[model samples]
Target chain A: MDILHALIVLANFIIVPAIAYGSQLALGALGITLVVGVLRFSNFAHGETMAFGTMIVILMTWLFTAIGLSIYPLPTALLALPFGIIGCIAIVLLTDKFVYKFYRKAKSTPVVLVMASLGVTFIMNGLIRFIIGPGDQRFADGARFIIKARDFKTMTGFKEGLAIKVTQSITLVTAIIVVAALFWFLNKTRTGKSMRAYSDNEDLALLSGINPERVVMITWIIVAILATVAGTLYGLDKTFKPFTYFQLLLPMFAAAVVGGLGNPVGAIVGGFIIAFSEISFTYAYKKVFTYLLPADWAPTSLVQLLSTDYKFAVSFSILVLVLLFRPTGLFKGQST
Target chain B: MTGGYGTGADILHDCTVAVNKGEIAVIVGPNGAGKSTAMKAIFGMLTMRSGQVSIDGEDITNLSPQDRVAKGMAFVPQNQNIFTSLSVEENLEMGAFLREDDISETMHQVFDLFPILKERRKQAAGELSGGQRQQVAVGRALMTQPKVLMLDEPTAGVSPIVMDELFDRIIDVAKTGISILMVEQNARQALEIADKGYVLVQGENRFTDTGSNLLSDPEVRKSFLGG
Candidate 1:
């Protein structure tokens, strides 16, 4: 009975939520890393960009539902993903054209670009709040679970049985597919190599005949895709709220920095590490530990190190520690 | 390709030096001698402060660096010469980025010029040693198929053996009828291959003569060559 209860809590609280949250952080961090590595700026507006993307997806989902289109078991928002990505891409490209391009041409310092990105972030924040009315919207429906908790218990004939939500499964599978595609694009494509070249050395890249404007355009487009996918997957797993999405910036930046700011692989690893730590530390471990301890040794109190309210502090402390010991990040990211 | 923007500051001070087709023109000077500045001024990296730069009898003083490349002027900067993260072939491809036509043939020509690069085509340029990286840099510049290929201190910081090998490649390149304009610190060896030579000091032409004339001249021998 004790072991079954422990397994139930573990499945429900630790494993499932950790993966969903980690995938979200990975996607967000990937966007941040790409911009820092290639475009050479710490884009404070990235969180707002994610919010705007989800806002677009929500609007599209609403339109599709209004028109009487039914996606059935799968969420309707999935069908509208392409439109959301396109819209997000256009917004990013326009931002680059109007704001970033001038700084690029003037050869402004990267810190200045960071400030500009903050300004854009504020504008994007206000814009999203205005359009979405700053409220949580439950836009997902249909096929809610791959394995319902009751079905799992009846099939296994055990007190604890694995229950896989449809959204949870989708988040893992979608993140895997998207990350694989991104890696392939970066390592195998011609334009991708050109971006790496530009990131490594700007003057030489220019001298080599690489079109700077074209590379910049493609970077924004790729970032848009990653941001939209990350944003949508996150909204699907949890409730969709504008402010909640904006607050994700802290954890996303934490993941990016902990992994080494400009390293893609590091960001993914860091995301999972951060998610696991946040969950494991805050989780009430009495149920799981009860199985290992002798009858009288088991304490009455829950063995949680901290409450869930302090989750943000966990990410922040980890970021500061990584910065203090290894400012370049775990992957030895280029400081430039 | 001329316009009415008259030469203003005379940074290059009405210098008339020439290298015929298929000849090496060596420019030599001490540190801060305006040697590189002069090359950059012609390449449009710096707005010449003054003086006309004509390429094959066309005034190109006002052209952008990319436009200069289109007009068959390839400049190899002294440092930061190649895209370090890019593979050797991709670096060459980037060199030919402006060309609408296919560049496979030009790439083959570069491989033939520097056979070492062929062996490391897939290797990143940054991983190569200084001398080998210089070859990649030169190969990238050659992808443009220019009428004139200019190099700034091609043998700088290289071993004596590598310097000799690089000089041989420079001569081989000249044999293909592509004019060479190189600035060098190794004055004596550089003058050995020079058909024409210019000695610059304090941003002015101090000596203009045939390579042999400057090499044997007492004034040139005393100050530059440490004879």
Candidate 2:
């Protein structure tokens, strides 16, 4: 009974939250990796793209709720997701056409494109802040918990209980579907193969009659879809704040770099690594360890590796360490 | 034709080269002889300031290299010719990217011509041996089933035995009624099998004749054939 209680406590505190957070990071990292692989530049604007998409989803969710529409167990934001995706796609394509097209035509270097994207980052940052007013927004409206702690305790006849948020379950399921669909598209479809070919060798792809503009356009569309879904899921899980989304750029970048910048599989794995690392380190082990250990041997201190406030520091440290030791990342993806 | 790279001087001075239907035309010259430039000019990669490149008298001088592929021309460059990261089958599939028609038959033909490629179809093209990668490059070009196939230094870094083997495959391709235009560093062996040969010197045609005629010419033999 004691061991089971300890396990349940661990699950409630660390496992569930990390899995949910990891899925969000995985989607974000995939978007970054795809852009890096296909477009050959690290887009600094990605965080803002997510923010803008989430902002649109929040606005649409508000409008829907105001009109008395409800999905009950599912967030109404799910209904507004397509609109978010459309808005994100429009902005990304317009940015590509008005901005990226010039650099590509001039055959500018990747560094130049990187700098251009930094410029794009500022523009999008301001645009999102202006539209959303730099405040936290409430969009999540659904049955809150899939498995309530109170019900679990009553049913199990145990001192410890486990809870699972509906949003958490939704994030995991949605990420699996998106990732599966993405892999299928990349491996089995014509356009997907062409994109991979283009990513491998641009000149050869052109020689093979693969259109560059079409590939670029398609990449942005996919990136937008990924960013919007990830941002919305994250917003549903936590508080929706533009600045918080912007700050997520560091962890998302760390995840991409750690996974291998241009490798899709690496991104997903990297996401979970970052999330588990952050959660496990920061979580206080006072209760779970108390359950497992004899009362005399129990730790008086919180037994946390780092304070929860220092969570972002963990990502930064991992990023620096990986860069120093293995710049190509675990999957041997493109460096930088 | 006369042109060079971007904003550069003309590398080929009014150069003209052609291959007949179902014949192999080999271009051979010393280093920096602009042998590849002439081939690129014919393929519309360079801006031909004064001459026209035509296939069956349909002037395609203004056509981009991609449009030329659509017009039944496939070019295999000397280096980085194959998509290294893709599987051999994917490389061939990518070759037929512009085709709306089914490509299973064309892929089958490619596999038939290079039986080894069929075995390694699932393997990454980069993992193949040097000779096999060249075969993949040729096989990829052949996927288009073009009327004209241009190869630039097809046997560049491969062994002598592989060179001979590639030459045999080139002959097989030509026998299928597709014209072959190739730039070669192996002048003696290339001219030996050539139906027609162009010995270019300083980007101009120094000798243009039947393969045996050039091989037998005293000046051509002394100057080029290392006699």
Candidate 3:
């Protein structure tokens, strides 16, 4: 019974949160990986893109709430997701059209593109702040828990109860669906193969008769979708704060680089790895040890490797280590 | 033909080369002799400042490379010719990108030409041996059902045995009524299979004749055949 209680605490503090966070990071990393792989640049604007999209979703959610319109037990934000995605698509397409296209035509270096994207980052950040202001906004309105702790205790008669949040379950399910659909599109479609070929060798792809503009348009559209979905989900799981989204760039980039930048599979695995490490390293394991150890054997310390305040630092440290040792990342991605 | 990279001076002079249906035309010269340049000009890769390129009586000089592909022309470049990360089958599918019709028949034909490719159809092209990669490159070009196939040094960086096998495959491809235009470094072996041979020197065609005639010509033999 004690062991069961300890496991419940561990699940509530580490496993559940890690999985939810991992899913969000996975989606964000996928966006980064796709842009890096296809567009051949590290887009510093990604986090801003997410914030911008999520801001639109929040606005729509508030508008729906004001009109007394909602999906009820589910958040009305779900209904507004499409609008957010469309807005994001418009912004990304316009950015590509007005900015990146010229540099692409000039055949600028990747660093030049990266610097250009940083410029986009600032503009988008300012735009999002100007529209929404920099503050935390909570929009989640669904049935809060799939399984309540009290209900679980009544059913199982355990010393400790387990509670699973509805948002956590939704995050996992949506991530699975989105990832499966993306993989299918990439592997099974003709356009997807062309994109892959284009990413592999640009000149050869042109010789094979692939239109450069079409590939670019498709890439932007996909990135927009990914960015919007990831941003909305993160906002729903936590509170929507513009600055928080900006800071998310670190973990997202860390996930992409750690998994092997530009590798879709690597992005996912790296997300989970970073999430679990962040959670476990900061989580206080004293309760867990108390339940597992003999009465007198429990440790006195909180048994936390690091404080939650340093979570981003964990991602940064891991990224630096990965870069120092395995520059191509764990999956041996393209050297670019 | 006369053209060069960007605004630079022409790398190719008044060079002209062609092949009839089911014929193999080989272009041979030293490095920097514009052997590849002449072929690029014909394939619409470079702007021909003073020449026109026509295929099957259709003037295609103004068409983009993609447009040229639609007109039944395929070109295999000398380097980075294959999508290294893609599977052998996927590479061939990309070759048929413009075709809306069913391509299974053409894919099977490609497999038949390069049986090793068929065996490793799911393998990434990069993982294949150099010889097999060359086969994939040619096989990919064939997927378009092209009327004219252009190859740029298709046998580069391959073993002698692989080179011989590649030449045999090229010959087989030509036998199917596809005109084969190729630039080669191995002048002697290339000439052995050429129906038409153009010997380029300093970006100009020095000799144009039947492959056998070029092989027997005293001037061609002394200058290019390493006699």
Candidate 4:
């Protein structure tokens, strides 16, 4: 029944791509979760923040390429990532000081903070467009594939071939490292625990002598790091477009909410789930079913659940359902 | 001292409250009497228009609430006192957030004082029963090993049995030579264990005397102690 071929097809088309996308989503959702927990508001500007960071990476990558700086066999963007992160840090910190801090000092409601973030989203959106020209920018330049489809086919003697991209591998590895470091920072370090304490009870944290401004600054720095890494890896795998990153806000939020808003582990889990669902729903499973079924029973139709254009709708649907059923999310995160 | 939250009406006016080392001073008043507000002002949680907060004669009126913690003062709020998501041990660790030195010995002392907290040290503070949560909150305040410990209705929303147990813990804490300044809703029970009591009405000190003396006073008994 050609089960091996079916599996290879699925692996080539679904599993590998979903994993990378999930890792990227997990990183994005993490940034959102950290802001939600400590700042106690839904940051509407998250997508634009990612775009801003990625745009910085793209510009740096172009400059590096112009200067003939090459990390060859690895994208030069890898070298530019830290610079992008620094830029991101500066931008976000400036935003906090100039805008968010005013509302915070006034003891504004979280809803006001959220609306302010939405306003920030527009400004950043316009800012990125102004600088980057709102066009697709490709920075990924490395060994394109760890194992090419043709090579895998030749080696395995299978009709269906599997391919693994270098960028995908990098995305997976970086995600694992980032997530491990984040959890360690949250659980083991003094400042991290203080942030958690601040998130848990602001008044009590102040009573315990945890400085609020320092905590806010640290949270922003951490958000900048996460957003940059996530955005860069995503831009490396996909193409960097300011509008695309803005659109990505929806799925990233879905991932965050599905996993549990303000719950870090939940963000990771939610990322993978949304990624798989989006891919699976849009995938045409004709080839897989053809390989698995007998010749006489082969279907003529594509057998896709939905068109690729509806991929984001899958996240939207899940988010709506989760909100309706379990508002706190699967991991029992903050209720409202 | 005279102050209120956000420059609102002066809830506290010429309210003078003091506690001695190793002594327990209980502030008792009816609801809306500004008992918690007075404690909050003393801890620098509110702006005092014309008042001075001192620690061993050092004027701390200008110090922020966070700075006051550095001056060896710990406060336990009535609600949302503990970091609910944090484990009990983490809550204690956070309490000692300002302490740069080793806190293991202090942790051990807290564990010994509240043995149940030691057992549930790894558990999330929010998941604990109400009484246990109160213990965790107190343990969190004790982590700083401060000279003065302030509690705002520490026994709030607990059963009478849990209240008695909490009062015992408070007495045990006072025995460790830390001054305890507490706002309590249970006037009779609080006055019984307190070394000194201040009965406040409309944010003004209506009665100030030794605990036994206030408990024995017929006027205080009739009005506050519910004789």
| Tens digits of per-residue lDDT for model 4, B2-74 | 9988858889999999999999999998888889999999988787989789998899989988888888898
In model 2, which runs have C-alpha deviations exceeding 4 angstroms? A1-3
- Residues B30-124, candidate 3: write the lDDT tens digits: 88899998888888878678888899898998998889998989999999999998999999999998888999999999998899999999999
lDDT tens readout by residue for model 3, A1-336: 787889898888899999999999999999999998889999999999999898899999999999999787888898999999999999999999999999999999999999999999999989998999988899999799989988988999887778888888888998999999999988899999999999888988898888889999999999998999899999999989988998999999999999888889999998998999888988889989999999999999998899899998899999999999898888857553
**CAPRI quality band, candidate 1:** medium
Position A159, candidate 4: lDDT:
83
- Tens digits of per-residue lDDT, candidate 1, A143-247, equal 888988889889978776677888888889989999999888776777887788787778767766678888888888888998998899899988788788778
Residue A57, candidate 3: C-alpha displacement in angstroms: 1.3
TM-score of every candidate: 0.92, 0.96, 0.97, 0.96
CA error at residue B141 for candidate 3, angstroms: 1.0
Off by over 4 Å in 3: A1-5
Worst 10 residues of 3 chain A by lDDT: A327-336
What DockQ does each prediction reach against the true complex? 0.56, 0.83, 0.84, 0.88
Best by lDDT: 4
Selected candidate, larger DockQ, 2 vs 3: 3
Pairs of colliding residues, candidate 4? none
The digit string of per-residue lDDT tens for model 4 on A80-123 reads: 99999999999999999999999999999999999999999999
CA shift at B130, candidate 3, in angstroms? 1.4
Candidate 4 docking band: high
Interface RMSD of each: 1.6, 0.7, 0.8, 0.7
What is the clash count of model 1? 1
TM-score of model 4 vs. true structure: 0.96
Q: Please rank every candidate by lDDT, starting with the best.
A: 4, 2, 3, 1
Alpha-carbon RMSD, candidate 3? 1.6
